[model samples]
Target: MDDPRDPRRDATSETAGNDDFGNEGLTSSDTLELEFREALNLANWTSGNRLQELGERLEREVELAARHESEMAPRVLDILRRNLASAEGASVESGVFQLKPEIVLNALRNVLFNGLVEASDGTRVTVATLPVTVVQIGVCLTSYSGDGDGGSIGHRLFRHDIMRRNSAAEQDVIDFLGRRRRRGMDTSAYGDDDQPMGISDMLCRALMIYGERAMLLERSERPWRLGHGGPMPHELIVGSGRKEMAFASLEMLRKLLLDHKRFIFVPSEISDQTVVTIANSLQPLQYAVLRDTTDIIENYVQGSSYERPHYKRSGLYQAVRSFQVDAGSKVLLCVYRASAIAPGRVFYAHEDHVHEAAQIVIADAALQESRGFPNLIDIADRTCRGMFEPGGLSAQVHATLARSGSPFRFLEERRTRP
Candidate 1:
């Protein structure tokens, strides 16, 4: 793990001129500007009258967009509202409908917060010539249950670990991954290839796998605090992204759907395909009556069987598939807008509590009208960052290196930069 950075390489690159890269004789600046203007004129001449036609087309597009926002959106909401009612009735008749908690005293008790890393790829190279790659991670899990007073009572579980690649620590991770694989968990995402990998690339994958394991263990603390004598939470609220809650092993996802039964994954960001579907499905609504209000579209199927090949490879698809298979009618995908102020969000719920999840998100978002994002997720994220300030962690690592008689001059040049 020698220092990958070499000052000689930068010096060589800086000394090399344009001619070294096979460039033709450089033209004068005036000639270059004249050539650019001539090319622009040629392009304009080639376009001819088509530019006017393009302008007219753009005008039509603007008109269509205006119609979509002012007219189509409201009508689409009405149809979605009707469909939601139908779904609710079907769920009730099927004996799967469950009401939201009346008090919601323990609803916000569970939250998953991501770890923070300062260096590129979660790995920092120490020493000047003979460098080693080390990864530092700090993760936290919070449970904020209601107290007797108006305020809330909360507790945080914290863990920190550092590992150097190809060392005993790395071997421990490899063995841990192997054990998880033996237990029917999918570790293919964290697999190694025959080709040589950089320290950053290797550490990136290792960090994700290790960080997820750390998060899972942290979330399983204290049974009494999680309600009903269970180590895991009944309802776990996580942010929307592949790395957030969707990066778990396939077996772990199935266990979450089947065992926990209430893993509420609210993705604040919607997909492009979903956006296109929403736009096309509501195109005809331009002729209908318009209203200004928030609405929900229930049971929105994300991708189709036609695109299974592309989507099946994604972790999100695996998570959604697990919910569909193990959670059955308990699963729901609700697309709802808090208001016209923001776009719609998807709630990938696994307990037939789509409306309730939407309500909680909306209510929490209302409290932070500035961003209109979920306050619970935001607060948890902020808490994690605050607890694990990257500067402090980096300083601690450097201090330990100094104490071990590692020459400060051997440190990477980038680490010494202001």
Candidate 2:
């Protein structure tokens, strides 16, 4: 929804400025990194624009490695190569795949991306060395924090790669689901070309809806103001203090929402009975569930991956579309899962105790504010890019904390204490 200068214009200006320098001027790693960063910027910024052409522009950025960035050639290609491979991989499990920049960076450095992921069906797989340019397709496909100031939601959404739809991945999904159907798993949606359902798909639709909603706002210009709602299991809602819970951005949003704390976004990961359980549990907090509005929003947006076909009855999209925020909540909104998919429930808690599991939540506002909140890891990766490369923020909070200017120097430490 952000309309800054056209990327075409930026590229034109850069190209024009480059005509005189020829191939020799771009040699320094500093220059290569800056340009690569710009390309990365453009890649994320391509949302809401002509996606295909913008994609070419992104590839052109990788191509910019020539001239004098020859040393960075492998790394640049690795970024692009990994992107395609991951796209293919995402198709096999979930109909979509999304990753944050930190995930990609780690994948690049790993001995083949092995330690992080664990799927819903108990499947585990590591990405194994991939590109820096994985599937950034569409708004919901983005990471927790973005490249803008303070890592606000708008900045994250804008700079994250959220492709509208991916035909290839969709095909991969259909093929996988077909195999499932053959095994009698009730893969009904595959009866059509594609279903616009999935965490990423619905999230994209929600954002587009918000954009439309933003325009219709008779009150504030702020689209992020709407409250949120959804179901949650007792362990996560209350706490287990022992077992790690599975959630998308729910808890992170809770801790980060200092003001917007009253809202939550729910996906199709939980059951309907559980939703009712969560709703009942919220009675003490004076919260109530609103009838779903999924049908209303469904008419407005479609699947966001680049080339995937869209169908009418995607379950995941409906879950998000049905989400309603309690405008009357005192200070917090809850987002839990509701499943017509599964017919069951579970609940329990510990506000003082946490699962000791590390979760990374992508959020707006200051990711910095989430420093010590349990169950959440604030990934302000891009924000600290310079510290690692002599290019990120020169004065990161951690750096300042580690430096010392005290008058006394410790004999063993050999420096003034911070």
Candidate 3:
């Protein structure tokens, strides 16, 4: 028989084993020793007023952030007003910005009940209970190197797929799956950098190229291409690339910033502090924190070097205007936090259209298990992962090289660690 109140028995039990000491029971003196060591280790840091000083320092940072929001909000709003005024299709009411929660709710209500989503450009899409068409792009890469002074090479794969779902039937179309092999050091890349590019950079270029290609295919005369009306359907394109609208590379961002096609690019993740600050500033009284779309800030430069010669001379802006959209009722969806686009450069040209785009994203995201990300993109990502699994290409290449009777030992591991 075991004593239920025995601490050592509980600690040693298979189902209730202790994490730190395992099944070993600690004596009173051993516990005292641990406490003494902990106190000794923290003595200097916990001594005088160190904690108070640290708290004060953190509070100062918070205060600075608050002050930054206060000073920057008006400047950003002024820029939006100026840009809207200069745009060709600017309305008389374009200067007025909507910051209230009721306005957003009204828009959402109309979308849910009226079943008619009217874009600012007068493109009215009759809403079904679900998306009539869904498009998603996926990309994956694997790299291999000769076990010598020779450089590495990379193989990349990209897939563009569309799914049509309605009451009648559901159909899937794998439009294209592109495959490319490139030297790791190739510098004739998208951005035209003079320096040799790495395998990771090659992967980024693949994503950008694949995304652009997907868009091109969408506009093609294929029977299943999007936005053709009559027989062809209208759909939103989702990408499994960068969480930011910028995608992975700058050149693709430049094209997206300059082109005004029927598209919406939303970042699946939000990490930029400036974007968070913008969301915090315009947070409305009705919604939970940072759940509403923000007033657009035109020509939003991403990094600090917007004034540099490389960017300024070519007018290449890495970042465009962005808005926050928290689709989750109480918590944030894991896939994305916000979306952004070029000012006056996308088909969703005006604020109302941008808001409509956000609403559409929220609606499609609701149908998926993730609750916040579009299902088609998630499906495409999974399909790509399944098809182009890690090391799958590498293993085949290594086997082929082995059978080719290469003189050099090319498949040797560079480094090994325990």
Overall local distance difference test of candidate 2? 0.26
Clashing pairs in 1: 127-410, 127-411, 128-410, 128-411
TM-scores of the candidates are: 0.46, 0.16, 0.36
Model 2, TM vs. native: 0.16
Best of the candidates, lDDT:
1
**Cα RMSD (angstroms) for every candidate in the order listed:** 19.4, 26.6, 22.7
Model 1, TM vs. native: 0.46
How many clashes (backbone atoms < 3 Å, residues ≥3 apart in a chain or on different chains) does model 2 have? Answer: 38
Best by TM-score: 1
The candidate 3 region of ten consecutive residues with least summed lDDT is: 227-236
The Cα error of candidate 3 at residue 317, in Å, is 9.4
lDDT of 3 by residue, 1-418 (tens): 1111222111111122223422268775887787688877755355464679868878987886556545664454444434645544343323312323333345345542233321100011111111111112233221111221111112333221222234543222222111122333333222243332222332343343444333433222211111111000001111111223233333332333223222333333344554444343321111111221222222133333444665445433322222111111111111111112111101122222333443333333344423344333344344344554544545554455558774235533542223
Q: Per-residue error at 131 for model 3, in Å?
A: 48
Ranking by TM-score: 1, 3, 2
Q: Which stretches of candidate 3 lie over 4 Å from their true place?
A: 1-41, 44-203, 206-260, 277-352, 369-371, 406-408, 411-418
Q: Please write out the lDDT profile of model 1 over residues 1-418, one tens digit for every residue.
A: 1121221011111111122312246555866786689878655453765778878878987985555455555444445434544543234311111112321212233321111101101112222133333444444444333321111112222111222255587687886555434433322223223222223323333333334333432353422111111111111111121233334433454455455544444444544464433433331101111110111211322433313654456444555544444445544443433433444444444334343443344444444544455555555455555655556655765677788887485567877789
Q: List model 2 lDDT by residue over 282-320, tens digit each.
A: 211011212222222232234432112221232323322
- Alpha carbon deviation, residue 413, candidate 3 (Å): 4.2
